[model samples]
Target: MTFFAEIFEGLRISWAAIRANRMRSVLTTLGVIIGVLTVTMMATAINGLNSTFQTSISIMGADVVYVQRFGWFMDRNEWLRSRNRREITMEQVRGVERQLTTAQAISPVAMTRKDLVYQRRNGGAVQIIGTTEKQVETGGLNMSQGRFFAAAEVEGARPVCVIGDDVATRMFPNESPLGRRLQVGDRTLEVVGVVEKRGRFLGMFSLDEVVFLPVTFFFNAYEQRPDLRIDVKVGSLAGIEETREELIGIMRKLRKTPPGAPDDFAINQQEAFVQNFNKVGGTIAALGLFVTGLSLFVGGIGIMNIMFVSVSERTKEIGIRRAIGAKRRTILLQFLIESVLLCVMGGIIALLLSAPITLVVALFLPAALSPSIILIALGVSITTGVISGFVPAYRASQMSPVDALRTE
Candidate 1:
């Protein structure tokens, strides 16, 4: 018979065997199903989170640069050791302003977590950012009502504030917050503006849970040290590279870094932080995938074991076929097709199970299920079937008709 004829014959026989032992065949394919489901679901969720963060970061403006004593989201050791280090003061902002004319705007920010109260309503804890008017534009904050503080207002330590949407819902539910007075600790400040809903980033902190006041007011009300950080925006988006370098040089000069010494201050860009997050997340995902793959590998071995047993149980039937002039290669192909069919069946079933779960996840959480994941699952199952089917088919083909009959 031709190769095509042999494959047709093998597929028919394989189908018969699967139908004869339906439960056994299903149980055998379950391993591949579980493995494919786990990896695909995780990949979908990670992809969604990655997309969400990228969008959020893009809204913060591409040309913006954050200057601080430490880098953004550094290791615990780096943070703990840098505790006693000097803070980035407003002077650094002025120094960069003086040295670099490439930047369009620059301002420092000081932050604190405090309980806020207005009339009878109060929020548990809120982020209070003491920033200049430049932060209104540079930080991607949009005012929903009233105007931001002016440069003069910041310098004069004006008691003006801008609140976020979450605080708006909590502190001023009924009335418009504009022109109302909200108490930040012991001092009261006039609400100049309310920010529009900025949504959540990093899957944790809501951007709308913040309130902005002038840094001068923060200093007077809290008696805090000058531990503020600066954000700089370049004149042209294309000039960010040159602008970053110019800012770094100015900071180095202001900090008086000696010749050949590395910069004490750190400049962190949005892309850099996103890259770091992806690296760490990718590593964890890879590790989990590896562990899950091992389970599937063990399952593949079980499939091979079952196929071997089936070949042994049908030794007499095989001998009869060989006696009737069936070629050894034909016999081999039959068993190979049977094994592949088993895995393919499992792959189909697994995919069916995974689709709804993926859809549900995408609905509840920010995630995307890729078509590649389904293709990969199919490929892995087919490959597993072929590989595990080989040895049993080889053993069956080696059996002799006279001996196969004698055993019975």
Candidate 2:
């Protein structure tokens, strides 16, 4: 017979055998279902998290650079121990503005969490961001109701505020927030604008809970000197790297660092954040794969055990086939095909069940259930079926027709 003809015969026999033992077949397939579901669902959640991060950071513009006392993902304990580190000051921000010709816009930021009160209405702890008007525009924030504070308001330390969605919902649930007065740390500020609802960055971090005011206002009210972080927006994508290098050199000069002295400030780009996230995320993905592989390994073992039993129960039938000019390879292929079909069927069932769950998640965030992941899952299941069925297939194929038929 032709190679295709033998394959057809093997598939025919495999399907009939599986059908004859429907309950066993279903039980075997259940193992693969668990394995595939665990892996695919984990992948979906990871993909969603990555999507959220990219979207949130891209909103700040690719060319924008943030200069601060410390990098975002630097170990907190280590940063704190660096006591000799110079705090970035307002003077440094001004120096950057004057010295960095490549920079398009620069603004300082200071932030704290404080209780907000609008007359009798009260908002719980909210992020009080001390920033300039340019900070708003450079950060890509939009005003939903009013406008951001002016440069004059910032320099004068005026009590003008731009409230976020969370504050508006809590402090002025039923009224327009604009023109209202809100109190922050014993200082009453006129709510000049309500910012559009910028959704949460990660699943755990909320941006809409912020209130923006001048950094000078923050300095005046808190009476505590805080490290200032400068936010810079480059004019174009091509100028981003040049802008960063220029700003770093300017900061070094302003800080009066000698030729050999290390720069005291940190310059951060969005790609740095993406790289940090991916590093941590890659570790998590590795752990998830290890765990999912364990489950798949267990399923493969179960398939091997059941296939052994199946071969034992069908010994007489096998011997009769072998006596009727069936080759040993034919017997091996038949059993292997049966095992693979069982796993592939389970994979189909798993895909059907996971599709809906993936859709629901994608509704809230971008999640790719790509063809690659599907193909990987199928390949794993098929490999499991083949590897685990190997010994049983070999034993059955090696059986002598007279010895197999004499049993019982």
Candidate 3:
């Protein structure tokens, strides 16, 4: 017979065997079903997390660097040292901007959390950012209506502000926000622009629940010295490392650090955040895979045990087939095909179970099972079947025709 014909015949025989004991077939495949379900769910969650983080980081601007007093994550000793260092100032921002040859834009940022009110409407505990006109460039902000505060307005510390999309929807639900006055703390400021909807940051905090004002205006309204950071946007992604080194050198010179002294300020970037997130993500993925892999391993052992039982039960049938001139290779192929078909069925059932689970998870996170994951699950199941069934199939193939038929 042709190769295709042999495969077809094996599949037909395998299906007949499975149908002959439906309950047993289903019970035998339970291990594979559980295994595939665990693996697919884990992969879906990890992929979702990766997608969410990449989106969040992109919004923060990959080419932008934050020059701040402290790094995002640091050791206790480093934190203490950073705390003692002098706060970044607007003057230093200007100095860096003046000296930077590869920077596209630089802006100083100061932030506070304040309750925003518009007549009777109130936006509670909104993040208030104080920055200059160049913030639009450095932060990659896009306006939905009107425009960012002009350079003159920033220089004058004008009582003008740009609101985020959530702020606009909340404060000016019935009317256009442009030209309307809003109360930021005790100060009344005109809303000159409304930012486009820029979803959550880190999938935890809403980026749109914010207000941006001129840096000078913020310093004026809040009598206390506001905490400051400088944001620098580089000309190209390729030169980010170079620009970072230059920034460090400039900061050291500006801060008057003694030669060989450790730097006080932190030059933070999205890449640094990504690297840290990846380390944590990788660990989570590894742990998840290890646990789920155990499930698959257990399933393989179950398949192996079931195949052995199948071989024992089919010894008479094997002997009969051998006596009828069925080749040993054909007998091996038949059992192996039966094992593989069982696993493939289990994989399909697992995918059906996983779909609803993944949908429920997506309601909370960005989870979704992709096509590649489906294909991988199927492939894993098939491979597991082949490995688990090989010994049992070989044993069945080696049966002697006379010994197998004597009992029957």
lDDT tens per residue, model 1, 1-408: 577887898899999998999988888878767765666666666677777777778667777888888888778888787666678877777777778788788878898898998987777788899988889767878888888888898989999999998888788888899999999887899998989888777656788998899988898888567677888877567888888888788888898888797678788777686788789788878886787678678768878988998898888878888888887887888888988899888878877887788778766677665777678777878888889899999998888878876655
Worst 10 residues of 2 by lDDT: 74-83
- TM-scores, each model vs. reference: 0.80, 0.83, 0.95
Of the candidates numbered 2 and 3, which has the greater TM-score value?
3
Winner on lDDT (1 vs 3): 3
Q: Stretches of candidate 3 above 4 Å error?
A: none
lDDT of 2: 0.84
For residue 125, what is the lDDT in candidate 1?
80
The number of the candidate with the highest TM-score is 3
What's the lDDT of the predicted structure labeled candidate 1? 0.82
lDDT of 3 by residue, 1-408 (tens): 566787898899889988998998898899999998988998888888888898898888889999998898898988876688888877788889889777889999999888999888877879999999999998899999999999999889999999999999999998999999999998999999999998888778889999999999998996447658999999689989998999999999998989998998999988888899999999999999898889988888888898898888889988888888888998898899989998999999999999999999888888989998899889988998898889999999998889988755
Q: Give the Cα lDDT of each candidate.
A: 0.82, 0.84, 0.89
lDDT of 1 at 122: 72
Worst 10 residues of 3 by lDDT: 219-228
Q: Higher lDDT: candidate 1 or 2? A: 2
lDDT tens digits, residue span 1-408, model 2: 666787898899889988999999899888888887777777777877887787787766777889987776667775775556888888888888888788778888888889898787778788888988898757888888988899999989998999888788888989998899889878899999988888887756678898899988898897457888898998688898898888878888998878887667788888888898899899989998898898888888778888898899999988888888788998888888888888888777887888888888777666768776688778877887898889998899999989888876
Clashing pairs in 3: none
Model 1 residue 245 lDDT score: 88
